[model samples]
Target chain A: MKLSCTIRKQQYQFSSVREVLGKASEEKSGDQMSQLSASSALERMAAKVVLSEMKLEDIYENPVIPYEKDEVTRIIYDDLNLTVYRDIQNWTVGELREYILSHTTGRPELSRISRGLTSEMISAVAKLMSSIDLVLASQKMRHQAYCNTVIGEPGRLAFRCQPNHPIDDPEGILASIKEGLSYGCGDAVIGINPNNDSVESVTRLLRMTHEFMQRWEIPTQNCVLAHITTQVQALRNGAPISLMFQSLAGSQRANEAFGVNKEILDEAMALMLRCGTASGPNVMYFETGQGSEVSLDSHEGVDMQTLESRTYGYCRHWKPFMVNNVSGFIGPETLYDGRQMIRADLEDLFMGKLHGLPMGIAPTYTNHMHADQNDQEIAGMLTALGGANFYMGVPGGDDVMLSYQDTSYHDDASLRELLGFRPLREFEKWLEKMGIMENGRLTERAGDLSIFD
Target chain B: MKQIDLDHLVQRVVEELSKKSQEAIPFPEEKELGVKNPHNREVLEQAMRRTPARIGIGRAGTRMKTTSYLQFRIDQAAAHDAVMKQIEPAWLAELGLPELYTRAKDMQEYLMNLDSGRFLSEESVRWLEQNGDKHKDVQIIISDGLSTSACEACIPDLLPSLLQGLALKNVSVAKPLFIHRGRVWVQDHVASIVRCKVVISLIGERPGLATAESLSAYMIYQPNESTVESDRTVISNIHRGGTPPIEAGAYLADLLADILRVQASGVAYAQLRVK
Candidate 1:
């Protein structure tokens, strides 16, 4: 019997680092000059970085463990990526290989590793002949390690220095740089709040920062420059402003005020538009004002309608050419009654439930010094209900500490908070609480429909 | 007048009708009904659970299981876009950004009113200027916690983190936007404003009987008008048995890197298909 040999070509091919390097070197030698021209300068830099970061020796030297994928593992993997939802424990080496081959779409460039797979498996997969690119690293530590392996110890650490802070001293900066460089710190950031800062101080600080980064051989792009402002100040200052409130009444009031303050707002917005183009920081947030001392009378003064109107009007008038992220703060009124806070009309108006925000930042908890367990839960639940991109205040407590131990403790607490909401576990708990049993068979009852249904 | 069979049948029918006429039928509205096929009902129930029936400023980042696949995809898309598009995440500082900007602007106007009557958050015509630049993007994730209560309690602390995280990320956040009344859609809308490729919302999914304050990540990629349910992904049920929050943050960064890798979001580039 004669077998057919098929030759296929495809677009968007993944080139190996070695191949790229060989071409680059040959170009330098005046040979293979035609092939070397395809890559742009940035692409070459990226290629060099990728090549230097990962070593073949490390990949092959890593251990591979024999493991079986279990039911729980399967679920986790499927949750991570829907493409591989079936049980793989029963598959033999041949079947596994075949499965991998089929899943790759014959690209020979990509690969997959399910969520629950062992680190050893990941290491093994990283060594495959076809696995020249696209390594799957699940954990943060793993990703960091991968970067380190490829980047080969950034010659110097990147740091953002704020002059006012005690830690921003030259000695402190040097020490921090030493620690990061020796320990493989990928990035360091510094925040400068201009309220209490001086231009002279900032200039000196920026110069020092720039010099330090340059001496350390860190790229300037790694150093980020930013300025922060608030909505009230933006409006008062001159920027077109929008208001975010807990109720519609506050929104309306703000809107009416916008009309009154149009001239001021336009001037402010126009200036902001100019600044935004140059600085690339143009976003606004409206938060319902809250008083630490909660009182119904004081809360009543916080009108939601007027606030919404103000926000709507501002957003409409300015046609804010670009918005980075928009959000509002939860007011004391929401805290008064948890049940009342989830009102449908209020959620729709506030969130634009029909439309989604790219960066929706909500609070998890506040008043850490005074909060109870119920309050914390409410914070976590609100995050889920609201649909946020990042949960910033996952673990907040104990008078706000800047020390390492405190931050670690807070991180642990936050992690614990997240674990409570695991999906399948929650699903199982719901089933058990309702006293309903499943036998793997689909059946229907002739009874009345459920409210949820 | 009829035959024996017809007479018997008529007698039986009359007896049944007389017996039933004395009892009153139960009303359908009053009866409590339970779901029989939970699997079939799960999609509907989950959707309902995620939706807010009435509008009110509830807790931020509460009752969201963002870690779930469905949720995280949605959250991430919005977050990436916020960064790429240059939109600032909301800040939870006292009175939030709007008030702060307004106060600062007012101070500027007060200084400028000697020459003119008005000033704004964008104008720098004051004796005292803001601590930072014009419009920086600060990506933040606030959770209402297990329910709406957590948001009310955690917003304060969340604000500090936003500042810290921004410092850590090395990018100045735009005037931090507060999402007082938040939901999944907030992320998408924010991304559009920010022009970032995606955004992740760290939220609290509804708690079960045993656990409260379970946090989640609702991620979205390229959040905009074209974004559908399929465009969103979730890393949910992030309480105890699920992925931890800090770990989630780290993992989230990795996903962000991945998002950067393919430049495609949601289901499109989340996974690497091996052949």
Candidate 2:
């Protein structure tokens, strides 16, 4: 019997740990005999006692929202002025922050409190405020403006008009951008795709978008640099598919079926470096998702390990131009929710809070089911906690359908849940316990407050 | 990132099914002939022939009719659900809808706040006009309700001119149409009923984050009788980042003559002879 079992084990191996756990669970629970089927009443009593002794507490604990959680949420809510934003007609940041913090009444632990307005949170708020203030101030200021238009007068020309970026007359595109900052437009954003277009067209469009912005005096937003990878099919017309999705499978095909042609990626990088040297803000947004076709097999290739290493390679290569801003760490929907924890663990291994280029998560729109919510929320929470500076999508890219309102509500809800709600009734408690006035200053006992406190 | 050749698989399965049919129909010649080099053109052509051309007329109650945005959303969701519910085993031969509908719904809910600045501007104009006795009706001119930011930033600066523009024309309107739906024709439709000297409709163009929420105005003079696309004038892309809303408004105020002269909308006024 032992010899036979060993031969059987050698013949087949379980695919994963979950499969083993599932088999073990089925074997342990498969006994059909009921407690009443015991030969004697005493045996049944023993069985009942064994079952009663099996504690369910092993799987769950009573939920508690600690004080620190409340405090942190209060701070963010107030700082963002989210409540006043929802109800009132325009509110100051300081005012909203004060209202929420003073009202919060709980003492959740610091860690328990959703890690409190992380650096990412702070930067997000700052960026939003900066944009808002700039817009408001510009409304009052004398500013020039431009629009992008396809024009045909003497010849076909693309005209862009913006505050500083104006391209009324263009002798040469590259030279116009080289003139720099004379035009009123703030900044120009140039985009380049290596795999999609050949070097010439890519260079032309990149140069044009940049030159137009330069003519308009727009400063410069980051240029999104891209590369195309193709895998050869041995059969038929020798067709090739883009490598953007091919990176999802790195291991099995690494030696044989798959190859990463650095020729394109390198050329794109070189052009970006040139652009970055001339201007700055060269960035790369990577695509990490399933390829265009559906397949039955689950294979790991171009895994997180390889991606992180390659990204770092690009970062090192472009250090002179500072071309960094890598976008994807976790691929989208290649795994089920049951498998996300493992995926996130892999992400941590590869994309841990490295400063040169921030990682952005491409969380799929399908993972918003209630069953999947916890996993999705955890993935987002981890990405934020892992020191990712900005998430490319808070909401919006839904199978590319462009359901605008749905994206907005999703952003609002995520903010509330991941961020937390401030206490609306804690103001009196704050005054009584802390003796702070409406302005958050000690009124009666202003002096001799404990430094430690 | 595993790339599976699904199109080939689909063709193979479909061809096998055709072989089993009672009529013994031959698979399209293009599909069968292309063993060495299966070009996409032939495949596409064969697929097109397999499916009959559908002519959808946009009449009310027909599939092509344009429903209100809300109605469109509900109907779309219902259709999606129905398809999922009745899915058959044979249909499993082909891949189905991408499993991201819920995520799309959730994310959509997150980023969009449609009513914030937009509905308010329209509603405010409606309320004031309803209460005021100065005119028999009101013209609630709003820009960029199509995109949230257009209204959020533009309406504050644009409102005064819009009001003044109406007053200068001696066009006292009742509570006017602050319809969220926008296109050149929408302005013509509203102008037909408002009966103002000219109906100035400020609507939002399509938006991107960088250029999104830019405002544009469409004006139609003596509008009625199924006015063509050439019945209005437009000043567009007005935002703090692009064209300051106030300046855009001021420019619109300056264009009253051009509007009256053209008696047209959009590119027609700029392009065609409008003497």
Candidate 3:
């Protein structure tokens, strides 16, 4: 394989495929923290050149982590459509990028090609594309899933109304849910990140959210973002659960750190199928971030972006209802600043879409990171333009319980209006009935939680 | 006067001026409803009272009202400042904590490099080898993880309560050490040096717009090569607004006692308790 590239009079050499992939990645603090990134800009460009020339078969042959050692690599390899892989075996990464961006290549072609591509190839092509390239390619693919409501329809966006409270206060969570609903958010899921992860607490929140959904007849799903074990326990105790939630990483070690494995996820999916309140199939919701593997010391040697792509590969095995990417949630050690955060969000949206998943972008930022509300808003708008299926709608863009800023209720409404998109068909009708939204715009009666009363 | 004394005097004057300026223009209370006449004003007020979320604040079109917007920005600014600010040396002295340093040369290095904040500096390691209490039942560490404001606000109250609680439990604790620019994993290093059965680090959490004063306690028992993140038990959201510092300290003492009795921590401890 070509491991060296000469750009303008400088020669750059990477020792291995993993090094080339890591070096070719867009600059983020996580890779630099792990000391795996390119040492200089010229070297990065060189790595990209080398990566672009490499064929898909090369990446397929050299998994970042050996398949024998890592279950994540095994899952990704074992799930490959070998017939499709043989068809695209000789295509270079550069050719793959051009083919993906070609006008001839729409969702049908892209979806077919996606079966042959590995996560490394996805990461490779993404590294070679500019921000606009990412946005344009992302806009071409829109994957849909169904649970309580259908997500990722054309000309529609959805939001997970994340109404979290510090102490798992039921009334506080309910109040935020009403506020979110008033603004035409929560069509994706009315999810809460509970402070208490006990089975009893999880069950109580599930019961409360389920009861609220029943009372108002909201056209959305409900979830408690607790540990999967706790949620499983809650389900066993006969709690009402619409969607099961878990945070997944790219590596087996990281998933183990999260107290989850393929068996556990498989069991959860089976249980949700049997006992979950949501409609047929697509009952799992997953949250992924770029830096989790690095922070947990589980990335091995792969770059953050590649690890993120691998996470998508693992996530697709479950056929999740929603795959929310929160690349900036880990703080400065991973993303560094607003620019890096925005780049990560764009890459994740495009990659997740290409992997045939219902993807949402949580263009989020912690106060400690050098990103502000403006940066987050820009990311939200750009990803929305990139055809993200949904975003997290926190009250006022501030998640008091999680202590980060994401797309807010106002941002959720604005994205729909800006894109000339309405809510999910069912949700829009429900909004019209509530007199909060009309003609794809929020009315004067909107943003007032008292309307629910 | 000495140069340090002059610097302190200047800081004091600046602080006083800021206080006076804050008093001059009294900001509207948080309790004031920002929404214009709602369909049901009483219910909106009650809803706003329930969660710290910015609800019931009527939007001007698809954006927040000016007051609500500024309030959010101001809180975000405070949280950013909290992350960047340094804890005062005099405050650490007052708390009687011997200071230790991590390998990070500055805040940028500390934030960007995980390993820089995870290990002690050469001088700090030497100091620990010389002066650290050895073979104690427990070791206490306090760090400005991401928010120094959290340490400044919560430690004064939390430390004393924790000490008292430990005393009541008859648990022998080493003299608590303060490490600058430290992360949670640094506690494992301190534990290795002190040879404690268990180590607890009260570190500042990543600041939120709601409050930059939140702290978290991470307790690990005999951290070794096999220890993963799940090996350490954590209690977070310790602050005036969340779990009050005093209450958190007492609860942490009880938790530490339980861990010691079980001879485990984190997931292992939880599983053992279930059994």
Candidate 4:
């Protein structure tokens, strides 16, 4: 594909990073070259960052945007032309390949983003592509992995209806489940985080969600994100265990919040494997993020990115169903803002996928956090483009109980429209039968329903 | 002959150390956590299971790790937002609430005059007196205190479940009401005028990042103008992210029943056990 800019007179095309490098080296380093070597025509232009020699500052405070509201942050957001999300989405395969390879590249005018477009971050994109001979080989491997697992397909995502029922009301629990599924969720796991961490509470939600699943004939697993002990109790009480779920962090303190350690996590995995009540391909689901260790005050001396990788190291021990990192959920203090969040989102997926986990993305944001729906959509687009195994599908990008906007049902629809991704095989069939989806496209009927009715 | 390349390695290390020395570098959240005492993890985790506080998180050199530091910041931000955040009146309809005000007219006035928010505006008092009975057995109110999301998130599940439980018990329950920009003390003002045996206000709590949707139920039996915070008993952290709103609602019903049976609440209610 050929990429051209409106303002610049230059037009050039090359298929490989080597070709771009050859062209780049021929020209003087400081010259304003509009078109380099590869693909497509763009109405807008984006400026890119010129990566300096490997400086120590780049590691910790390279793209230094603070969490506190300030002038720089205002400029970062207010700069309308710096459309990282839009620019990246429009970039060609050749552009992405060269962009990942070149450290000294600047963005097109509109591409002057704060974080994800950085050479430092795009290094992850490089790691993601195993080699030029077999492009998206990792994605194929990921698809194969999912096929082997219970989920059975990449991009066939799942979401838990974590309705904070202050009291474990079965009706309320069912409402959340129905609400999630009506919005085209429940492709992966239909789960609830029991508000009260009691065994009884766990069992009640299990029965409620299970009843909904059967009534609807939705092919899904039921999970409750309670403590492992509560899950164990639920198991002993003969409660069904489709996806044994927990929120895990690499640190002892972070995992301790969920009442888990490496040893305990292993034990729980063993216990889950033995739990007779099963439904899905894999038996476990885990949620993690960039700042979990920070939330628990556990990051020792390692950077957030490295610390996150270590957490993934812990998660891989399970080799279970899915591992999701709400890349931007930690707010801006550590991640700073949307730019940082985007970068972290890319890095986390790269690392998670590299570590041999069936990766999922939950693009989340809080009101006071560094991101919002716009930011989440950008991150979601990137993940969708990056070939994430799956992601959380929520209603209107809103998690009422969690008080954050995660990846929305609409986002899933949009991504599938853009990238041609679809949900699990069985759920897809169920959707077709429900007439919400036909062939591969979501019907107008899909968007019109209300669970309240 | 092989080149050692000690100079290159030393140069890189020196550069890293120099940058590190310029600014504080935090350790990873889980670095060397249980090296000295392996049991320390179990100890720390055991304590952590009980509360969401910074107890045993190891430090990075002389400073806190980036995780702990950010955690502190997020918590601080959450608390700050809880105090200063504004809730709009338009969404009250979603919760099946008709917005009512105290003496304080707006958020600024409410923040400035805590006592004013406790007392209903004259118009509101007149409306209440005109439409409602004075000697009610129990009055339930929902308020947006510190965290609006708390009430908005929890009350949907909490109120319905609670009302259902109370109804099943054949308990005398008044029409549910709301307090926009209301405080815990406001229950006393409504209770005194209504002459209720018990008043329960499911209000928002001081939120942390991890528990922004947490709600608190403050119950008082026969609360009057003289009622203080100590006179009210609270069942708190009621949200989907904490205690399930339905569970909190159900539990609140049991607690409110006890208060009604004993004709006492809070500290006194604890002393006078209800049948």
Say which candidate scores most in TM-score.
Answer: 3
Give the clashing residue pairs of candidate 3, or none: none
Give me the TM-scores of chain B across the candidates: 0.43, 0.43, 0.87, 0.77
In what order do the candidates fall by TM-score, top score first? 3, 4, 2, 1
Who is ahead in lDDT, 1 or 4?
A: 4
Instruction: Return model 3's CA RMSD, one decimal.
Output: 6.7
Over B170-263, each residue of candidate 2 has an lDDT whose tens digit, in order, gives 5455443434323344443344334445567676544432244456676656656544333445455566645577766666665654555556
Q: Which 10 successive residues of model 1 chain B have the least lDDT summed?
A: B51-60
CA shift at B95, candidate 2, in angstroms? 18
Candidate 3 lDDT, A194-267, residue by residue in tens:
87666788899999999998988888899999888778878988999999999999999998888788999999
Question: On a 0 to 1 DockQ scale, where is model 2?
Answer: 0.01
lDDT of 3 at A217: 82
CAPRI-wise, candidate 2 is: incorrect
Q: Write the per-residue lDDT of candidate 1 for residues A1-453, one digit (tens) a residue.
A: 011111233122224432323222201101111133225444433333332333323312221111131221222223333333233333322233333345443322212333322222222222221211221111001111111011101121112122122213343333223222211121222222221122233344444554554554432112112112122233233332121111111222232211223443455455444532122222222222221111111111222221222233223233221111111122222232222222211232222211112112222222211222343345334433333222222111111111000111122223324533221222223323322213211113211112112
Predicted structure with the largest DockQ when compared to the true one:
3
Docking class of 3: medium
Candidate 2 vs candidate 4: the DockQ winner is 4
Q: What is the Å distance of residue B25 in model 3 from its true position? A: 6.2
Tell me each candidate's TM-score. 0.24, 0.28, 0.94, 0.50
| Candidate closer to the true structure by lDDT (higher is better), 2 or 4 | 4
Of candidate 1 chain A, the 10-residue stretch with the lowest lDDT total is A139-148
User: What is the C-alpha lDDT profile of model 4 across A269-338, one tens digit per residue?
Assistant: 6776677356334677788887665534444322355446556655656666878888666444445466
lDDT of 1: 0.29
Residue range B125-226, candidate 4, lDDT tens digits: 887777655676778888887688777678778888998889887788878788777777778788877777888898886554456777888888886645
